[model samples]
Target: MSAFGAWTTAHGLPAFSYTMDQERDPRAEWDPILEPPTRRHAVHLGNRRITLVADNYGLSGLFDEHTALRWLTRDTGVTRVGELSTDISGSERIFGPTFVIVRVADDQVSLERTVLCPEGEAPWVLIRLRVRNLLGEPARLTLTEEWAARPAQVNLISGTAPSTGPDEDVGLELELIGGARPRRTGSGRLAVPLLLAAHGERVVELRYGLLDDTAPSFEGSLAALRDRLPRASAPRAPEAEREIPWHAALLTGAACADGVLGGHTLDQGSCYSFRHGFNGAARDPLQHALPLVYIEPDLALSVLRNTCAWGSPDGDLPYALGPDKQPWTDLFRPSDQNLWALWLAAEYLSATGEEAAFREPVPYHPLHRAAPVPLGEHLRRQFRFFTDVVGRGEHGHVRMLNADWNDMAITESGVDRELMIAQGESVLNSAMAAWVLPRYAVLAERLGDLVTAAEARKLGEELRGLVAEEWNGRWFRRAYGPGAVVGDSDMWLEVQPWAILCGATPPGRAAELLRRIEATAAAGSPLGARLRWPVREHHGPGGVGTIWYAINMTLIWAAADHVPELGWQWWRRMSLAAHANAYPDVWEGTLSGPDAYLAPETDRPGRTWDLADLGIAMQAYPVANLHSHSQPLLAYLRLLGVEPFSERAGTGDGARFASRALTVGP
Candidate 1:
């Protein structure tokens, strides 16, 4: 049994086990796993198992190991997995009244199935499905099935068959042998039978193979073939996470939709750190702060520190990292660049509470005697850039304030300006540096250089002063600020409170900002977070808007620090947004033309990394953990309730502000 396993044992859920029979290769030439999802829609065409939601109302678009691989290809959004079909002879599928179908108006679906092999290995799959409901409701009811075969090396799943070779044994059958059942014979491959409530569904699952290996190097895979599914069948894993390597977060509420997600893994540690910024550029520093936000604190903090080191002797950082450790992009947004870096590092250290760890040398850029990343030099240069340079002409921040990308604001718009300075301004950077400079100064003091500590104190005070002076515009900006105010980012402040919560704003302004934020929150569209006071238009880059995914991440931090009870509020809003938006999965932007709004389409480049990071970022929420949160849920709730570092966000000085409301735009 696995450590988590225990039926008769202490720590186990009701245990049901299974074993499979030996099978002949149908064809060495044919791949087994069928269609893989181009994006994380219910559509599947790769080597992944899937499961479906019972209520069709929640997470109907989400995918799990049981979502039929065949259905994924059909371009359909189905609530439940159908029983395996018997007549897949031609292109047509088996249909029925109880089944769900994609609408004809939304004919993006084509009933299809395929066999896929993952990296040419042991676990293979075969799936058959049709998309009749993805674009809209369907004309006829239809469902697909998939057969997935995997040969796992570790068998991390307890109560599952041990890793005996495929040739060595036929599949193992788990029997609900004795005890209570009126005498009856359950035959064929052995298994557990779960009685479903009328019109209700339950997750049927099994994890096999962990009984054997412990090494990461172990190689084993699944092999599968499509058979007309069994009687009254459930579905495949129906979840995308079963196939993609992801960490998940969780949310719980009755009104909540089926899928909830916190974030996705962009790099190993970063979550939501843009893989590429404006003009498709990416920053390496985010890997430490964003990716590792919820997973590994020590490693994440290390990434943040190293990123800070990249600040040049003149105090600039490489725009992005190349494969060769060279800077990739040249355009840097000081708001996103410096401030985010500082916040992330301090966030990590604050999270761990192991101040002692701060004394050590960070990775890649260091020599124990004297690391070259001299803070004094870099800080001075950065100070000059923000206070002195950057710009003031036609496209300057002071001029454009609400402008898109680097153009600044000319158009009146929504939730981005206070957001801009709050993210970039001197105070945020100072606040972050405040934490570090002092620590480093303390280290210097301990090392007998009290003078450095004194200097550090000055820097800290300066940074704090900057915060009080700027980075404060409350509520969701109705537009940009005073001098450089863009008529567009009409100054309201839904996003302003986050600045206060994140420490970009001064503590005194928090209550006012919080109150403004609460009033600005949109209540009508479950999916749309109002861009401003009146809530007229949508706000975002890819055109789809940023509220849905962005809020999932930020809210978790909200719950993590000030209010765990608020998690339900976050989930309700996001869940409703997903449905109000009605996307099979998220889109790069909202759709206005001939296509479905950013919903996943065949061969489309997707926001995979974002989804992964959402899961990681959710760790602050204290609702779900790394293992429990996955798509479509975790992507929507980056603040998984339970996490590795709840110690900080959950009960720190920040906790004092939980009940307080923040008013930013006064």
Candidate 2:
């Protein structure tokens, strides 16, 4: 049995295991034994990530390490026999629910280890190991941890070593009930040795902390971690209890403090780092907060409040918020940051029926800021920055002075008084305005701010009209700059879907628009949809090209705009694209999540890399990459002729803030 299964069975839970039989081409680098635990085999409790694999390799990631302690020498690190075999006493076993424990037994001994991470704490991982000697003679074992080095310093303190490295800091400390601390056995090698009597058993635990807060006493931190062990190994309830799909539990969990995340893996580490800036990018965290509003309301509120704390008094949300709660404005003035903030607030209010949360006093404000205002006032400040401050382009649409959602869409335009420039009017931004402004109006009206509600409704209508004008029957254009209309040059994929979502498309036209989108944007590939069409050359990763999972998700979301069945079809396609068998011989991802993007549909030889098997495209939140995957639920409800937020809005849907209002769809 796997170590996880062993633990689960030991705890009275039934264990189930399976293996996929497939013929492998000798040239393919992917090893069947090395496939990261299938999603089902992985157990993630809160922010703790524990995955069980079939071999002593533990997890085949950049920072991956097998659990058991081995004998160490000056010349060699850890010894390994190729693959697990059935011969003699040699075999690998897996354990249950989320397979997080693995047991490997040989003629000489049996060893098992369980991995876990605790919630709302330091980014730390814990490994618990149990070993029993099988030979008649006593044996001495040396436990070793190996990962590629990223930073320079390694400190050992009270069995708690906090190491600082580049981009991220990592600390690994070994704790034993009555054992010796790790000693430097050879050049750059650290290990702890223990001798076991014939047929004797031993247990040891290792704790790893990322971004270790050295300020705390080591004993205190160690005790806190120890307190969490029972909860980690306990037979916890499934994520399905929250009404989410089992497969999507990881996405929702990671959005909050309860999820276990692999600490940032550096270039020097063994596994590729899927760094979607934790300290940077206002949009990233907000995207994570989207679905979280539905599942974990308080966590959602915390994310919103913390982000707005870094907002400038002028109403520009910072592109990056530092740990000090300060804003980083010099890198780029993100054009779309404020919109995401507003959307987050609206979604939270809609999902939780909590107007008082908005009315609560603002918890944070940057330096030179005025006395604290209520959250509602902060939101209005952001809207005013949008209306009175950030002016429209020549086409009367929102300007992409710095950059919109597409960071690469930056222009050479210089800055203005607001520290923003007018590069062009983006249809995507304008459509987003049209879609979200009315929602904001709904929110304002709910909060009894009639004047703000009227203003938002008026602006939303005007922007919706402009977006409609940009739709030339076949597809909506991308944007209009100082002298030219983009996407009119060639049908681009960015703006049309948003037009449908925002109700800018005429009632009878949404379905046709979706059909046209499918034909053009997804024309080249069978595996999935491309981000755009007519691949604009020499634009770097830009133009109507490349298969980005983000764009595909948006398109699927658009598909659900009116027709539930259509939306389901696209959703199924997206899910299938992530599967290894979905392709003839290639496995896209080692785990059960979509890759960042597939290779360009045109490249036959390199097409194999498009699947997640390439490793570099591995991401933490693929489901909510560009926009939150929760968007589809809203669309699905609409197709069923039910307004998602209608129940939440209640009878006060007309003008008053009700405790249970829902978004009404036409």
Candidate 3:
């Protein structure tokens, strides 16, 4: 076993251990767009995203809107131990929730490098290198580090014209402590001298990050930052299951704290290859903050407040917030945006029991100079938007204006999108509203708003009946449209779980639907469940026969509500261990993966960024830090019997463990 394996075993966590001597790919090339280095781990804090490759190479650069301004690559930081001539060899790497450890050793000396980006308001990365002497007699050692810093810009989005921005000076800055004064050997190079007693250990600390105006100053000591680094508090579960929450924390934490958006706002993720590091989605921040309510309630509350601030006076939310902190609303009109805000506000209040939050005044979008309103008023506007602005269809289901949760649902070929947007109805959104409104009504009643509470309960009951009418004997239909009904013949996995969760399906019928889902959708892929069964081709990305992490997470939640054993089984199937075992060649699958996975039948099995019909073979959007990370964290909590809404409604206890141990069943 490697050092990482030993550490994981000692700590009761699963190990994704690698020995570089055998696993390192010597032929791997470096290209940010087409063939970037595989097996990479990134750390994020405040406004910076730093990546380190598997073979101890660093992708050192300053992040911009579309790509990175490179200061150095490949040999970003090369360190030599002993005699200043001996090379460091025999490397091993291990990944933790928020950190990565790399160990290299020679016959006379050993070095362990721990890299971390602590959680705080500063944008910086810390590298602590500990070197130990193995000789019986006192040894003289010299440490030399070198890097070639040449500033150049690389465009990650292929075939598009490069974006021009303001000219700014950006480079890598380094500060070293606990060693002799560093001597500048050459350009972008520093050498530190050290002497150690026999079998003695010495520590060298390197604080290096981007030096730009966007980065804030750090007044605290390096030791203070290191001490505040986020550590994983293991949940009570099987040894293999403990790593799920740890991975969830790392991915969620990595996507948070984009100071440009808001102090507590979360970006999509730090996956530069995917071009999602800097933007914020209206619905994503609410989902991403769900896990934080348990770990950090104050930060979670701040996220709720910041997300609510993006609402307009008419209660419409922008599709997404750009890197410039501007709203993008010209693309599509999504009807499900406000629904998420209402749902999250209720969840936050239920989990924390912070009734005082309702009275806190929050401003509208900065573009609108309207007076601030109480948080409760913001939530009420969201509810009214659904009831008035985006009114119901003829069938009493929520209007699908352009699209709903499935962005690609009404975007198929040969369909008049305008007509469909005007008349289409989404059963998925209806089920969600049916589930969210009544629960939110309880909170409203507690806050002494009887009128809104009564109105909410009436609307919720009406939508539930409308949803029940859409059942097609076997399962629920996805949507109602003029051209052809979706999920009419084929079963859509997204809506069925929601139907069971919201009590729209009868008890016996819900059980039958879940069993059929297990036989079809869940059986489609060995890696959890597919989005739909009886795969059909569509126009663009994420058509059919795909396993989306966000959708499947809801499946786990509903399954845990009815059948705990089956829920645990599906949860294990979607585990990182399962992904690694299935696709050993894909590096991201082992550490982290994209938001969705192509089914086994696709050309790129277990991989993302496959748009073959559009003449794009693979665009290299590999890294994902979206709801995929957050939903799993929420699902795991649900499996542990933490149902906040139910607990607050006096139906169950919040954050309590299940009556018996949950184990994987055959």
Candidate 4:
């Protein structure tokens, strides 16, 4: 069944939409416009961005502070809006409110505009402006399009100087088409009359682009813009088939000028920083690449190769892998990253029928000695480090040198290097290891390494059993720390779900554990699920009861593990959050995109556009990879006995109900 049909049947209908009508006649239906310089209602097109708030203003870059376009009334030489009433709408084109700006004066010449990010990499924004004669008599309406080059040094190495007086000469240029030519001022401002009509209604197609090598033409640009809308408005794929187009668009947006992937912050055409740089994250790109390998095999292969290519001498993947690497906390090496590499490599082989990748050599250095090893051999070495080296602890789980995914350190000093073994074993990381190792073992056996395969399978089973012991009858304890469980006082929602995904949770106890999660971790908030239930005084960096997309995703995976209906609910909540509603079209609580992590419950519905929110939003796009072929909607479909990819032969029962939509085969 179509995703829309299923959604409507299950949840009535989607509460959000794009069309909002003011007063309509045979002449025109004045759709609400997003006012200028808006915080929440902004549509990004390439580097050019337009915020729909009280005024029709825009800037360049995904989430930049530079004001590239500001609305000005040319007829009266006035800027900004007078008075307004807002009606919000959301669609696949953009997710925000549409607005109608009233002049609030004697003239009362109202301007209605709608902005959208047209599909394509061309650096241009599309805005539809409609001017109406609201008064009894005809009115002369002329709106000015202002373009200015503000002098601001963002991400400058030597630090930015305070704005010297306005006399600090900055070069600016402007080109207007399909409207009256704009006049340029020496102060880096260009004003163009956008709408000039004294009749029933006048519509102007405003296509604006930043300065580039080729001048943008109305015909070429407009054609490109119109072509994208059809695809964006194409029939919604079925539940299990959504990710195909979803990730394609997201990955297209994720492309950097330097040919690398970065986000969870910023959007398409935005500059990359230390946080979301090409070499920034060793694990994030790999994580993104896991499910992505199914569609964009070459792109996913490149990301995996980049991670493996940049490994440290000890086969340790750094926390960040960019040219200008900046680690969030360098105290502990991330053991999970290397494991992720092996898992991805195994997945790559499973997805594609290519075995040349296995024989391909990758550069490595364990003791700073330069040597290249085959890709398969490199992955085996990394898996050994993950298990034999970093996986050491008295608790028989992976040792938390500093932090796992939770990063739940109880002290200001972070995890002590000397006391790491004594502190606790990472149940989350170990559980993941328990899950991925068996898959890796299968790959090894296929590659003629029976010894490694046998050993990995044995260790994987042992680790799975060890992690299962942490199940405290209700939910799994966070970790086995010194003399006690670290988070035994309350549930750390992040780690518990992994046992379900990794096949460590017993069948009899799985249902009860999910119930506990729903009661504690997922309760109280419509912002999906929190990382924990009750807030600890200072739960360290991961913090107490903060909402993270990672945990929310795991919640869906666990829900898919047992109850498909629960998975659908979580997916609906995430969809509602993205569409600016919690339930239906009723706009009440917080309107947030799928962000990296919301602040702890103490902060309530935290800032919407912070920390990789777009990255999280991409996961909901249905095509973007969520690791293990495990998209929430796809998992639900799988639970409903639907096989989207029934062309291939199934591997085993383990492949039957796993989160992965694509099984291990070519």
Query: Which prediction has the highest lDDT against the true structure?
Result: 3
**By TM-score, how accurate is candidate 2?**
0.67
Candidate 1 global CA lDDT score: 0.28
lDDT of each: 0.28, 0.47, 0.61, 0.46
User: Which candidate do you rate higher for TM-score, 2 or 4?
Assistant: 2
Which candidate's TM-score is highest? Answer: 3
What is the lDDT for 69 in model 3? Answer: 27
| lDDT, residue 596, candidate 4 | 35
TM-score result, candidate 3: 0.82
Model 2 poorest ten-residue lDDT run: 68-77
Error of 2 at 494 (Å): 2.2
Q: In model 4, what lDDT does residue 590 have?
A: 20
lDDT (10s digit) by residue, model 4, range 1-666: 111111211011111222322122121221111112212222222212222222112222221222211121111112222332122222111222111122222256555544433333333344455556556655444455433343333231212212222333343333333536533344423233433344466665444333334444434544443332111110121322333233233333343222222112112111122112223346656765554554445656765765675565456666653223222334345557777787777777776757787887766523245677777877877777777667668878887766665433434223444565456678888887887788888778878999989988888888889888887766777666566566566777777777887778766677778877667777766656766667544322365545655567667766665865666566554542333333222121122222333433554243222223233111111111222122332333333333212343332223222222233311
Q: What TM-score, to 2 decimals, does candidate 4 have?
A: 0.63
Looking at candidate 1, what is the lDDT of residue 247? 21
Residue range with the least summed lDDT across 10 consecutive positions in model 1? 249-258
What stretches of model 1 exceed 4 Å from their correct place?
1-294, 305-311, 322-325, 351-483, 486-489, 492-495, 502-516, 528-533, 536-545, 548-567, 571-666
Regions of candidate 4 where Cα sits further than 4 Å from its true position:
1-57, 62-252, 257-281, 290-299, 321-332, 354-381, 410-418, 421-423, 444-452, 534-541, 582-603, 606-666
